[model samples]
Target: MFALMQSARLESLHLSVDPVTGLKAVIAIHNSQFGPALGGCRYLAYPDDESAINDAIRLAQDMSYKAVLAGLAAGGGQSVIMRAPHVESRAALFEAFGRCVEQLDGRYITAIDSGTSTADMDCIAQYTQHVTSTTAAGDPSPHAAMGVFAGIRSTASWRLGSDNLEGLRVAIQGLGKVGFALAEQLHAAGAELLVSDTDAGKVRLAMEQLGAHPIAPEALLSTPCDILAPCGLGGVLNWHSVAQLRCSAVAGCANNQLTNLQVGDQLERRGILYAPDYVINSGGLIFMALTHQGAQPEAINQQLLRISERLTGIYAHAQAEKRSPARVSDELAKKMLYGE
Candidate 1:
């Protein structure tokens, strides 16, 4: 535990177990250089406690980089709830989790992430004030999708010599809230959609409603397309998938899309333009952070659109320096956060 904390430069790690509600949670604070640590609470089934801890730590670190790159006056933290079999009483579980967040006393703020929802945030809000994405704030998935759409346009402009998505083939690997919303945006822009998801119902819905061609989940990565958008989970772009990717660019809403730095290098070698995940996928975080500061809705909407500008700068720098966009983004974020 100490090794992981030290390696990730984590400032704090808190573990909470509610025997009555059967909630086991880990909260990791990666940095507080800019301000209070801010991130979301992720609820998911994990293989083991060690895996959960590793995920919390790694995600917290990414949040730190994400905040710095987006110029948010906050640090990075994450909360992970381990979903166990026969878990009973979600309200009790989240209330207990909210208490854990309350104990942090605003040092870390919690929002919604995958496997969690706005309703869950509303439940959590019943216990603590540090939570966002409540019933009033609504879901941030659409805003996140907007950012990804803007990123796709910028990337398309650089890679395909046009910013238009009309008739451009885009294979989206998830049809969840953000992915489905993104599909709506792309479809309205006249992009050809190939979608996949574990849920057959979602895949079928995409096919029927949006005219998206449904691909089996297993075949999403290798399907020939102009862009491969993995909006589901992280670690999907490892060496094996990178070698098999048949796309000009990869950009989506998933966090930690690359397994490691070397995988990003491999994508560069393969001539795939990877819009660094943290840089392009920061829209939701930006929305949450700005809303937390009581920024007006119009201001938040305008700020979210700047994601394309930020990505364009990163792409330009990558081209000028002859480096991968991932490397350039990492270096720029580190310079902003640590001046090194």
Candidate 2:
């Protein structure tokens, strides 16, 4: 565990367990040069404690990069609550997790992430004032979707020599809150949508409302399209998948899209324009960070608009250096976070 933290540059890790509620949690804090580490609390079933701890550490590191590139004065942290069959009472479990967060004082702030919702954040807020994305704070998914839409436009302009989405095919792999919202925006922009999700209900809703053609989840990645938007889980772009990609560009709101830095190199070699995941999918973090600082709505929107500019800058640097954008992004973020 100490070796993992060292490799990831994690500053601290907090573990807590509540036998009564079957609550087991790991909170990993990475970097604090800017300010308190801010990230989401993920609740999901993990095969083992090591997997949970590793996920928290990896996500916390990504959050640090996301926060730095988004120009926020915050670090990165992530907490994961291991879902077990023994866990009963969701509310009680989250409440216990909240107390765990409070124990960190102001070192870390929690929000909603995968397998967690605004209501879960509300439960966390009960124990610590250091939480966001509560029901009262409003959902950040739509704002994140909007940023991704803008990013796609930027990517189209850079790669396709035009910003027009009309008549272009986009394959989206995920139909959750953010993904569905992004599909609506893309549909309105006249982009042809090919969507897939684990939930048949979500796929049906997109097909009915947005006229999206449904693709099987397993086949979405290799489907021919102008772009591939992975709104699902991370590590979606690995060796096997990258070799089969048929798109000109890959951009989405998913964090840690590439399995490792080497996969980014593969994308570059394949002549695919890869938008760094953290740089492009930072709208939610921007919203949560600014909201926590009491910034107005307009201020938040302005920062969101900067997402495209940041991506374009990264693309340009990558092009000039003949390096993958993901590599350039990591270098730039490291410079900001550690002055390395």
Candidate 3:
């Protein structure tokens, strides 16, 4: 009951076009204790309207907590689009989507997310002025990659008791912009990599760039490795998928990775380390605030480092109380912002 009430503070938007393509659109808006609601617009080909709506609700809620945890001024929000290929390229729907954002009048600022690109945001920017970028001058992806990499290192240190990533076999699902960028960082840190994606081109590029071994999408799930990173969509780590996993730690940039809220306890029972998704993937949001305010990296780095500290504390609290990391994360975030 305590957990359920904390989850209801998020607001959501739902849009869909039926019979034509069965595509749906959803947006979530999480307001700030500090300022207005802000985040990126994500476009994806979801299975249905309900899925999009669920994604929007969960993402917006995650953003709200993420902002609080990361010590940012803005709150949480995300937009989702379910589309049929060629009918709506990101170029078309994203800008039209920006029209939706314009109506919000800075109440919610949209940037980039999964299935959305800077190129997509560039188009969206034409429609609305309340937009943030990872690349206005210094793109946030690389910096975000750096922060997540730092987080991974921190996780390794906590879990493995060693800072060295050498010879660590990490399996990454969905090598998109952020994942690919992260792969390079891990490579530099001496981690052996296994990567998978639906796009053959991205797989090939990852193999060439990071020297990662490629696994097909189906095969990617059960790959025997140290870390299981999901950088794609949400709700991948459920009762079903958790039964299929063959890794030690779960980490990556996917939001709402848990299908049910209790799955983190299930992972812990299975002897798997679960790095809460909102905590690890928060670099994007932190970077958004940093760039939006035109601050230097030095100052922003301090904020992102706080994410690591927050994770460390959550892990400790979860470990001590035998609680799920996600729940612990929520409590800690609420504690920081609202004095809970």
Candidate 4:
């Protein structure tokens, strides 16, 4: 693990284990060059401790690049709690986790992500004030979905020759908070929706509420659609899956959508426009950062509007340079962070 961290150039790794509350967590700070580290607390069950540490390290690095590209005055960090069979004492676990955050002494800030919720943030806030995405700040998922929606429209405008989503077929491969909210926006815009989720209830909800067609989770990528939106977990667009995609473009709120950097080249070769995941799904981070700084709601919203504009410029630059959008975005983010 030390060798991996050294190879990845991680800043620091902190592990906290509380036997009484059964809380086992890892906080990985990837960078603090821009400012204090800011990231979400992801509580999930990993196969092993190594998996948890690896996830924290990778996610923390992504957050650093994401913050720099989004113009947020924060660095990158992530907290991953290994889930166990102690659901009855979840609050105690969170409180213990909060204490861990407090120990960071403002170097790392925590927010809601994946298995964690705003209520969980509230629990963490009890032990430390360095938290965001609480009830007071409202849910960041909708804002994230909004940014992805804007990116999808921008992609359509560039690739399909129009930004209008009317009658456009969109396959959404997840019905989580952000995915469902994104479905609402796309449906309102008259887009034809094909939704899938591991949860049957969520798929049913989309079908009943948004009039979306149901697609099997395993078949979401290959399903014929104008756009493929992956709002679920990462690594869906791997080398094998990239060859199977039938969509004209890929855009969603999921982090690290591509399994490897080479997948971007594959997408380009397949003639599919790829919206860089961090660039498109930065609304949540932007919201949490500005809210932490006490920015007004309007100011937060206006900042989110820049997401689409940034994506548009990236797409245009990619076209002008005849390069992949993913490559272009990486260069831009690196230039912003390291002045390369």
Considering every candidate listed, which one attains the maximal lDDT?
Answer: 2
Superior candidate under lDDT, 3 versus 4: 4
> What's model 1's overall lDDT?
0.91
The ten-residue window of minimal lDDT in model 4 covers 84-93
Q: Candidate 3 residues 45-120, lDDT tens each?
A: 7676666666677778788888888878788787777766666354666667767678777777877776667777
Across 222-327, the per-residue lDDT of candidate 4 in tens digits comes to: 9999999999988899999999999999999998898877899999989999999999999999999999999998999998889889999999998899889999
Clash pairs of candidate 2?
A: none
TM-score of 4: 0.98
Worst 10 residues of 1 by lDDT: 134-143
Tens digit per residue, CA lDDT, model 2, 195-306: 9999999999999999999999889989999999999988899999998899999999888899999999999999999988888889999999999999999999999999
What does candidate 1's lDDT look like per residue over 1-340, in tens digits?
Answer: 9998998889999999999999999999999999899998999999999999999999999999999988899999999999987778998899999999999999999999989998899889988899888888768888889889999999999899999899999999998899999999999999999999999999999999999999988888999999999999899999898988999999898988988888988998899999998888888988889888889989887878888999999989988988899989989987887798
lDDT of 2 at 314: 96
TM-score of each: 0.98, 0.99, 0.89, 0.98
- Native-to-model Cα distance after best TM-score fit, residue 299 in candidate 3, in Å: 1.6
**Alpha-carbon deviation at 126 in model 1, angstroms:** 1.6
Pairs in steric clash, model 1: none
